[model samples]
Target: MSEGHENAGWRRLFGGDDLTFGTGFPLTGTRESRPDVDEEMRLAAHAEDLGFDALWARDVPLYWPRFGDAGQTFDPWTWLSHVAAHTDEVALGTASVVLPLRHPLHVAKSAASLDHLSGGRLVLGVATGDRDPEFDAFGLDHEARGARFREAVDCLRTVWSEEFPAASGEWGELDGDLDLVPKPTTETVPLLPTGRSRQSMEWLGDHGDGWLFYHLPDDTLDSYLDRWREAAGEKPYAMVVRTELADDPAADPEPRHQGYRAGSEWFVDYFRRLEEMGVDHVLVGADGDDPERGLTRLAETVVERV
Candidate 1:
């Protein structure tokens, strides 16, 4: 909650009440092989050209085949840094980082470095992590994630804002002698806790700079927004929408995994509805065989129209 104005990324994406658009990585997703880094980068540039507000990266440490989905297939920090170098003004973000699995100092250092690298264009979406197998692999207790998440949040805030900050937690103790350098462009990097992250709504309101949530139904979202606004006043709320655009501009929509398959017209109206409901930003994951095509169409019809 102590970031926005000093961070251009936060201002651009979360400043206005009208919903802004951003695209997640893996522009064209892969099935059995790794995604094409070259082409993905190409689309990233094109996305900025198309006026996309932000470029989001996913954090998938190890791909589990049973999950049936490999995330962007890249480490979020390195990947975003690469993305930062390639683009000019477009914001850079993490859809959500698994805080319990990584050290808070590492996260703080990486995020601060990236923020400086990107001209303060980083909005770190953090989570407690959902995959159970990941916890076992990392030698962590699954049930203790909530506590770990809180610790990480505190650690990051402390190290970034205070010089030689002292802290002790599940990760490790940071003695008051050594300090983290290359402090973020702001008092601290903007952190938006994603999903529930094993945390209560009240806690999110208190700590988060903002909130990042997955796709939700209209009725459900409205209800959730009611709760969110009451708890968090003026703090921005962002959500993802999985969409597959159709060739026909007026084509109807059908439910997909966490979103819908629809034409530009419907997508426009859907976004308008979200904007009206007080949604700040919408991270659109182009869901289909050819993501660039869907992206182009969305930019033309939905983004422009909105």
Candidate 2:
């Protein structure tokens, strides 16, 4: 791994198949009537104890009928704080907080609070929200989100860094002294840009600490990484893959989201190929409804193989 990648806890926690395995918190599902919030926290903490690297939550403020993933069942920021107190080692990240939906001041304050409380284990992934229902609910113009998102990013970085930085933009204003107390333990928190979010390639290169993307073919992966290297200069890269595990290692893969349904053997080969391709981190979503069993199987049969 490169020095920049090495310095981020994500590299240590999610670098290779040997030590890098993460299990996501399933907030929205038909499995059970919203398993108690406290119970959810305990399960996530248990994943850390079980040797998982990170636990990711989603920012689904309101369930859009079209995008029907209930999404981790809670307000992302408050849930992160509650989970941070219960777990000691597992890193916390949001799949992405729609940057334009919320106030940057609130976003900066909550993020810094979690970073401080967790001892610098927060990895923030942000995006310009896409769902129309959400945009409507907040009375924000969907078409203008990209511009708003760019502005929000600027405000967040400034609010967290400057003792009293003056920010004037389309979003709002931050005039006068603003401490934005408890700056991240690291000079700045690690940020991963998701789905373009209206940022130009050059802008991403200069500002983004990392990139978050969905799965891609090996060749496409290489191509994107090359572009990222150009923009990233020396930053690391990360992505998400949603796969389904079969009951038997010999079971063939079936199509899931960017990932495939596969056996332990296939999963092992998949990650080995990813590592060889220079992918620093791969966030795996639980394959099935029974996340515990799926995670345990991956840990025992696949990760152990590495």
Candidate 3:
């Protein structure tokens, strides 16, 4: 809950009470193929210009036909770094990086490097990963992901915050003989656990800097927020909603998978409700024929008005 860190990006996104908006990547309509790098970069810069608080990138190491979504179709570290260089001020976040799939040392190194490079704009959302096929492909035990997740988090915190030659249980042994260079601008990068990650609510509150969860109904969201407050005690809570904005300003809401298909008016009211319920940041996936137009419309109609 303390904002004494050097990362201005973290301060800008989570340091206030007003609801903030962020857009998911791929900033284009291409779902099955890779997005045009130039177009995505342009839209990313445009989003920053439009006053979006953050830009989210996903980690999808491999594509699965059943999963159906490629998720920005880029390596999250590289993509965030590229976006970091293109825009200034807006926070750059990973919608999530699958921690159990990769080594904690590598993740810590890369994340710290990015934090320094971007002047502390990185917010890392990590998960145990949901894809069964990915676990098989990686030659990892899907069932053990939860345990691995805990260990990886411990490793990250130790290496980022403690002095060189730190020793972590089971994660690895970092002898004082050598050190991980380029520590984060802050004492530690903000780590937000996506969903439960097979962890208890108390554990999340104690360990995570914040919580990143999926969309929920009004009643459910309220209950969850209440529990989170009891457990996490003012730690930030973020959610993602997949929206398809309508052209009509007065359009009502129609439910989608986890979000809604609605007009600007409904969105404005919905966001206000979320703010009232104490939700911190909302990362939006505004799906439409013209993704850029969808982003601009939300920025103008919903973000500005709210």
Candidate 4:
């Protein structure tokens, strides 16, 4: 795998050149304003049973009507705790927790607890947060998010690795006074920065264990890989793809937002191309009407066959 990601859940999932697959939470359609917890849990367990490498949950602390997506309608930490109790092996990840929105100490403590509880299966994907209203609602200066993001990353790492009283700028200084309990099973939890997090590629490469980005076209993806390799040599790169599997196995590809609508045959070939391009892992979302059936078909055909 990569240099710094040796003991990470991400490395376990995307270690070699095999190009593994994972599925996003709320596998159901986006039109449903709220998610059914029971159904989601069943589907999550089923996805793991179907041989998916990871199960991702998003951190949407508040539902914004304008954003139009409720993001599984649960707290990521709480929900993942629930998932950890039920599943034995599937990796659990936060498709990204907004670091700038929450206090870094809380994030560090909660993340560490989850990592220990889940037997060291936490890969934290963090971001600067995109929703403008959320920043306003939190009474934070949205413009300063980039700076806060960097600080939070530093703070999280310090609290997780150092003894109490560690001095962290803006996150507050601990003078050997108190400690954050339940450190991650490993020395540090894997941190994958999503979409630059308002920082430069150099900064990301230096700090992030991996990169979690949205889907890109083939040519765009190749170019991205080139830049990422230059900035962070051999670090894993993961993307999310919205997939709608057609009934006919021979269907052609149709472009959707960041992904495609296609049949199993096309998907297998497409993923092969992704593997060839050095893409590490693909997070698949079943975008069809029946999420359960869609995920089952994807597993039986594209996921399993590929």
Candidate 5:
């Protein structure tokens, strides 16, 4: 249950490789909270049962002004912990926790607690937050969040590892005499970066265990993978895609956000392309349908087929 133990377990299970085939947080229907947490988690459990490797949650507190959709529509840590209680095998992750807005201790505590509760199944994706309004609300500097993020990462690791770890930074002071309690199951949880986050791709690849982002065209995907490979020295890559299922297997895909609106046939083929492109995982966002019916059909057609 300690952070070191969790890190060790993470290394033991994952072996520092990418895990493929996960379900992204659903965003179907209105955000007025009709779809309860249990309903959302049942969908995730189905994903796990169908051999999907992971489930992800998104972190967006108050629906930022410019950002159109409110992601996942829950408090992310609470959601993850709730989902963790329900599922057995699937890895639980945040697409990217907006680290700058939160105190690192809280983030570390919550993430480590989830890891312990889930038996070392937490993958902590972090980002230097981009929403200016959020930073303003937190009294944090968006311009300097990148530096703060790095410091937070370092701080989290230190607090997890050493008893009474010391850190000197503008963010705060952890005078070498205070260490975090109930450490993560692993010494270090899998720290993945979302997008560039103001750091160079090399910096990300060098420091992060993996990367998460929305889908891009093949050319862009390849370019980004190439950069990751070069900097990572064989680190893995990951991404999420939006998807909608149709009744027909051969239904042509219409353009959705970062992915296409496609049928099962196109869906399977998309995964193939992702695999060929060296993507380690694709967390499909099953938005806009009856959650059970939608996921069931996809499992039968796309997930089972391929």
Candidate 6:
């Protein structure tokens, strides 16, 4: 119902409640290692061929060994642009980008440019920096990220939707004399606020085009969905689930990280349950020795079936 949902990428992902699927980056599940680019590209294209609706890239500005994840080992915008060239139709997403660490001008320009080049296929998920080291490295006060996050959201919307928009913030000042050009392919890109991002549900619901949440227990997730419906109306609800499809179609699921390790049979049922509960999209952090193969298997069994 939002203006930006008119964009092709947004419509593709949230057009229905059948629970569309996406694959997350760091496909190899490596914490400290950089994945092979060629193979990643193959998988990126493969995912689209397999009928996955989107490919998500994470923003890891620096690999804090303590954190143990390097994301995709490429800048989200650049890597997504490369992926945009490799595949057609599938949406491009940032799982998300750390907002407090970068200036909104950069985010606005980069996001708008990607949306332009990708033919309106960009969905920008934004968040406050997750790691304290990133805040220090960016020379920002860690305590002020919540406020900065709000300002950055406003700044991005202002710049993208207005010509020569004037605004001021801790990041910088924008005067009406200068305009940000190459506006997005839609009214503006649909922004999905990642996690809480230090904001209350009311704000996330009011401001974000959608919500990106993490895996949660059944009762907890149901509660979240209920609250989300109340706060966000029919705006989409998307979440990440760790999926590792085993060779046995009947294998049971066990808890891993924020999601589950299960057979694709279970996953089909799992996803249906999510869809019934009003989830619009599900991003799979699929894990395996050969993640590409696992993705294919999941698509064959779960994505197609669900």
Question: Comparing candidate 3 with candidate 4, which one achieves the higher TM-score?
Answer: 3
Ranking by TM-score: 6, 3, 1, 4, 2, 5
Task: Say which prediction, candidate 2 or candidate 4, comes out ahead on lDDT.
Answer: 4
Give Cα distance to truth, residue 215, candidate 2, Å. Answer: 1.4
- Kindly report which residue stretches of model 4 are placed more than 4 angstroms away from their true locations once superposed: 2-8, 30-32
In order, candidate lDDTs are: 0.87, 0.74, 0.88, 0.85, 0.75, 0.88
The residue ranges of model 3 lying beyond 4 angstroms of the native Cα positions read: 3-6
Task: Estimate, for each residue in 40-132, the C-alpha lDDT of model 5 and write its tens digit.
Answer: 777777777877777777788667646765677788888888888888867888878988778888888888888888888888889887667
Candidate 6 local distance difference test against the native: 0.88
RMSD versus native structure for model 3: 1.2
Candidate 4: tens digits of C-alpha lDDT, residues 56-83: 9999878888888778788999989988
Which pairs of residues collide in candidate 4?
165-174, 165-175, 165-176
Instruction: Estimate TM-scores for all models.
Output: 0.96, 0.90, 0.97, 0.96, 0.89, 0.97
Error of 3 at 111 (Å): 0.2
Worst 10 residues of 4 by lDDT: 1-10
Q: On residues 187-285, what C-alpha lDDT tens digit does candidate 1 reach at each position? A: 889889999888999999889988999999999999999989988887889999987887788999989877999988998999998999999999986
Better of 2 and 6 by TM-score: 6
**Candidate 3 Cα deviation (angstroms), residue 12:** 1.5
RMSD of each: 1.5, 2.7, 1.2, 1.6, 3.1, 1.1
- Candidate 2 residues 1-306, lDDT tens each? 343333244555544544266656672233222546766776787677777778887787788666767677678778788888898877788879988888887888888888888776788889887787888899988899878887888887887768878887876776866568877766666777886777787777777777778888788999988898887775667788876777778887787778888888888888888877767666786556666676767777876575
Error of 3 at 155 (Å): 0.4
Select the stronger candidate by lDDT from 3 and 4: 3
Candidate 4 local Cα displacement, residue 193, angstroms: 0.4
Clashing pairs in 3: 165-175, 165-176
Tens-digit lDDT track of model 3 for 55-155: 99988888987888888898999989999889988998887999989899999999999998888899889999999889999899999999999999998
